[model samples]
Target: MFVDLLIGGIFAMSLLPLTTGYCAYSYGRSFWLWFALGVFLPIVSYFILFALILRQQLDHGQRLLTEAKAILAEAEEAERVQREER
Candidate 1:
């Protein structure tokens, strides 16, 4: 759980600039507005990061499935060739 929080925190930190920029653009005149956003933005940023990471993981899983299928096919071919030699 610690690792998850650390990852989320790191991701949130990375988005700090963008969050601050948006806050400035939307409510720069109000000090309280920016302050409130600064307080809540990290959690939202972390969720966005987590979603992106999840998408990447899904893509990786698909690639791994393809590779696994290819490996299985090769192994079957090798076994068939070996049987034919006997």
Candidate 2:
């Protein structure tokens, strides 16, 4: 998980140049100001993104388990019916 987060943060940070460039151009700010924000935002955003992705994965796993249980129940019922007919 830590590795995944780190990888994601690195990828996220790649966009920083565009953001900082825009901020520098539009706001007429110094490189340092835009650079600081550009650096900071991705760390925060990456953490949030990682958490959201992890949450979604867990939810999907739970749903899969529920569906598997439902299918098992149906199969059991079918088997019971087969035995009754026999």
Candidate 3:
């Protein structure tokens, strides 16, 4: 059972190179470092790295999304004002 679990994890990680690569890149680390971790230590490495590091990158993404919404709101308001003046 234990061996099966580890094998399953390795297989799962094999399918997630892009996600692992993204995490590595987002953390300003080496892609091969994470790719090897996923390939070798699958479950533990992903949980440890992603759980700790992903939140900061996700927060950055959220901030950018918020800024984009603000910019869109400003543009829409300007459009409304221009229409009102006409």
TM-score per model over all chains: 0.33, 0.33, 0.43
For model 1, state the Cα shift of residue 86 in Å.
Answer: 0.3
* Cα-based lDDT for every prediction: 0.63, 0.64, 0.77
Cα lDDT of model 2 by residue, 36-64, tens digit: 65576845544444454456557977668
RMSD of 1: 16.3
lDDT of 2 at 59: 95
Model 2 residue runs over 4 Å out of place are 1-58
The digit string of per-residue lDDT tens for model 1 on 1-86 reads 99999999877765664565464544223444443555677566445544544565579776687679789999999999999999
Runs with alpha carbons beyond 4 Å of true place in candidate 3: 1-13, 54-86
Residue-level lDDT tens digits of model 3 in 1-86: 99999999877758766567678776667888887877777677778777767575479886687679789999999999999999
Best by TM-score: 3
| Number of the top-ranking candidate, with lDDT as the measure | 3
Off by over 4 Å in 1: 1-58
> Positional deviation of 76 in candidate 2, in angstroms?
0.2
